[model samples]
Target: MKKSDLALGIFLLSAIIFMIIPMPAALLDILLALNISIALIILLNALFSQEALNMSSFPSILLFTTLFRISLNISSTKLILTTGAPGNVVTTFGNFVGGGDLIVGIIVYIVLIIIQFIVINKGSERVAEVTARFTLDAMPGKQMAIDADLNTGAITDVQARERREKIQEESSFFGAMDGATKYVKGDATAGLVITFINFIGGIAIGMFRQGLGFNEALDRYTILTIGDGLVSQIPSLMISLATGILVTKVSKEADMGDILVKQLFSIPKVLYMVGAAMIFLGITTPLNVVVFSAYGLLFIISGRVIANRIEIAGIEEEVNTDESSADEIRRPENVTSLLQVDPIELEFGYGIIPLADTNQGGDLLDRVVMIRRQVALELGCVVPMIRLRDNIQLKPNQYVIKIKGTPVSEGEILFDHYMAMNPGYVEEEITGIPTFEPSFHLPAIWITESQRERAESLGYTVVDPPSIIATHLTEVIRNNLGELLTRQDVQNLINNVQESNSTLISELIPKLLGIGEVQKVLQNLLKEGISIRDLITILETLADFASTTRDTDVLTEYVRQSLKRAISNKYFPDSETTSVVTLDPKIEQEIMGSVKQTEQGTYLTLDPEKTQDIIHSVGEEVSKLENLGKNPIIITSPIVRMYFKKLTSDYYKDLIVISYNEIESDVELQSVGMVTA
Candidate 1:
């Protein structure tokens, strides 16, 4: 065992022994001094600690000290009654410190007990109880705040976990303290009872056993009893004061002394007013002029010194700030910071600032938080934290969305206007400024609030400026989710899955496919706008087919077929015969025949002219489906699906490509056109 642990064990065992055994006078004196020293140390530590949690073990310490002190009180009582003396420490305290008068000593001891029991102990107990109650009641809110920060990417998982742990510690500390305080109260009561018994029992024993008269007995035992009470009560008072200090501490991030000094004495004006008031009182009142004048002048001088120090500190702070800026320029380590880049950033100009600022009644931040949740649910991927910044170079209304520190999309919005787009049935064109929807590039118009109601009545879809930005941002993130799916992100998903399906994760990860390979498969699925939310099915499929091939594209195809139910529900509406274009059997054969396999992966080795012819034919068939007001979905044989999708990916970014195996058998589909080259 550790020496400290063994020492504590011995100390507790000694307390138990002190209660039952007849301790020697010298040993009693030594233990009494030790008790006082411990209480003083606890008081000072509690007074200076930055926060209550710094002394989380104080509740248990309170219990130990109370028991030890009570045992010493009993030991001292026994010595005083039977031996007619306790020790030099107690006798000296009875004679010198108590003024050698029985009434004076009794009065002093009574005041200490009253102060501890009625004032300090009572207040500490109440504060501890309330603090525990408040901490427990606020736990849910604190938990929610942590979750909000985690969701918005303001804090990492580790940081959130640490915050949660700190909160739990605080709750437990206060709750235990609420009960521990009762030990202090009970100790005080027990000491009062012990003191009474010592006086009564000592006087009776002296008169009857030692044959001393009432006056001599009263005088002798009264002083010793009062001395013993003072010895015990002083340490108890210190502990009570310590408990009060701990429960009342407010600041946890700085030194308690510093915080108190800053709050009480930092302002020179308050000190100056006090100095003037003291001087006025000294002159006008019947107070001692010399003593009051000395205090007044001291205060005024201190105030002036404090004012000058404040000014000097401010000057020094400014100088340090300037020096730091210059040092940053001179420092080579600055380059390291510049190399870091945000995964996603949104830069806007001044006009749209109100939409992003909550103080200006903007819900842009709330919308951004929701966008992350929306994407997580829709795509089963975490979007990197989106940083919002303002750029003075752009027009007031313009904003840019960047991925990996490079601008990919920019839009301009009228802060006071709403965006109205025709759903194609609205014939009444509103008089407004012409614009295009930022997310889809469909023709839209900027309309004022006055026109919004009329536009909606005319079957035109109207959206506010904040909604427009959020929608555009969501679309950009969704489209680029594949690129955003980092290896770390893949590992996070696997860890989450491992929490429940540990066997599947351990077998598939590192055994068959590595994180990078799994990331590639997930990225491929995301690129095709597939949801990997059902990770179990995805992992199970990968583990099944992984031994045959580690090629990510082929694994992704298998995973997609496993997720066919979700895909069918997503693309093909229930009980509806969806119109889709089909790959011509002849063209599928040609594409399969042109396929080339290498160690790296497979690629289409079709003739350049033939590829162009096939691309043109795919576009023609896609347009036919588009004109039919249907999504441009192309169904192909399972084997040729991935290659065909890759062949057309460059030409059509939003094209929906599926295979025959991925479609549900219950779902109906009609092929309106065929891609043939």
Candidate 2:
């Protein structure tokens, strides 16, 4: 076991032993001194701690200390009743501090008991209860604030986790403190009862058992009992004060001492007023004028020093600002500086700056971060950081999304309005400015915020401007993920996969296929809206097939066949049947015949007219399926699936093309339409 753990175990066992076994006066004095030292240590810790969580172990420590003190009280009571002496510590306190008078010692001990029980302990208990309630009640809001910061990239994952853990610790510390205060309250009550019992029982034992006179018994027993009470109560008072300070502490980065010094003397005006009042009192009152005047002079001098410091600080701040401004003006800008471009950039007009500015209460950066996370989960690749800035050249409501310095999508939004799009079945019409939904190019109207409920009631989906832009950005990135996956990105994926499947990575990478080749396969999958999250499975499949072929297209087809279950679940969910369009047997055979193999790779050797006729036929079937409210998934034989997807991807990017072998055996296919040529 650790030395600290062994020491704690031995110490707790000693506390238990002290109650049953009586120790000599010297040992008792040593333990009593240790108790006072421990209480002082706890109090100092509480005073210096900036946050309650910094002393989270205090509740358990409080319980142990209270038990230790109670055991000491029991042992000392026994020693006093039997021998008319508790210990040197108690005897010294009774004689010196209590003035060697029975009446004075009893009065002083009673006052200590009353102060500890009624004042410090009571106040600490109430504060602990209230602080616990507030901490628990505010937990959810604090957690949500952490999440918001995380989503906005204001904090990273590690920082967010730390903040969440701190919040939990604060709540638990207060809750434990709420219960621990009861131990203090009970200890104070026990001390009061123990003192009374010690006095009466000691007097009876001294007179009846030891044959002492009444006056002698009273003097000896009372002095020892009062001394023991003072010894215990003083430490109890210190502990109670510490508990109050801990629960009442406000969480900040600076300790209580620093906070007090900074805030209590922050303003010189209050110090000056107090100093003047003290001087006036010295002049008018019968109090010692010299003492009051001396304090007043000290206060006046301190205030003057503080005021001078504040003035100097202001001057320094202004000088620093001037130097910074001069440095900025003297710095030269070069044309090469403008050559750096963001991988993804969103430019907003000046009027829409509030949508991205955090100081203006805009959550657009947070929304963009969430969009990146969502895209990463859906596409199995991290979206590049989006740089948001204002462009003065654009129209006031306009925005543009750029990829690698080139604008790919543009849209306009009314900052104060909501975009309501008809779900294609709404019977009621809403009046507003007609516009196309930037994400999907669907007909939508920009309506006022007040019209949102009515528009929703009429079967329209309403979204705010930031959400509209975020959605547009998501779609643009999803469509262009192929261009973003460099060989380095593939290496990152391999390194990630290596953590769990080292054997597969070592065997597959740089052996059968290089990173460039793997990048092509990943791009091919991403280009078709397929997720590459299952990298281990993809690499394993490649390990088996890559040795036979260097062709990326052929390899991609093989990988697709291996991911049948994932692909099937994406479109069909939990269903056992899939609705799809199929080609006629003649058309399938004719297309298969046009596929020619060469040294470079495979190619389709079909005539232009034949291909056009086939495209038209397939387009008609797809349209028919769409009109029936079904996704247009085309099922072709395994050999022609890749070629067919390549042929139609430019025109029908949203169409899903799967092969016969790609369908899981448990799924039944129901033909909804057919393409014939």
**Highest lDDT against the true fold, candidate:** 1
Model 1 residue 674 CA deviation (Å) reads 1.2
Error of 1 at 187 (Å): 19
In TM-score terms, which candidate is top?
Answer: 1
**Candidate 1 Cα misplacement greater than 4 A, ranges:** 1-289
lDDT of each: 0.92, 0.89
TM-score per candidate, chains pooled: 0.66, 0.53
RMSD of 2: 12.6
Residues 1-677, candidate 2: write the lDDT tens digits: 99999989988999999999988889999999999999999999999988888889999999999999999999999899888767799999888879999989888888888888888988999999999999899999999999999999999999999999989898888999999999999989999899999989988998899999999999998898888989998999999999999988885789998899989887898889988999999989998899999888888889999999999999999999999988876777554567898889999899889989899988999999998899889878988788999999999989999989999999999989999998898979989999999988999999997899999999999999988988998899999888888888899989999998999988988888999999999999999888999888889999999999979998998999899988877777766576789977777787789998898788888888988888898899899878877888998988888888877877788989888887888788889878776
lDDT of 2 at 231: 92
Scored by lDDT, model 2 comes in at: 0.89
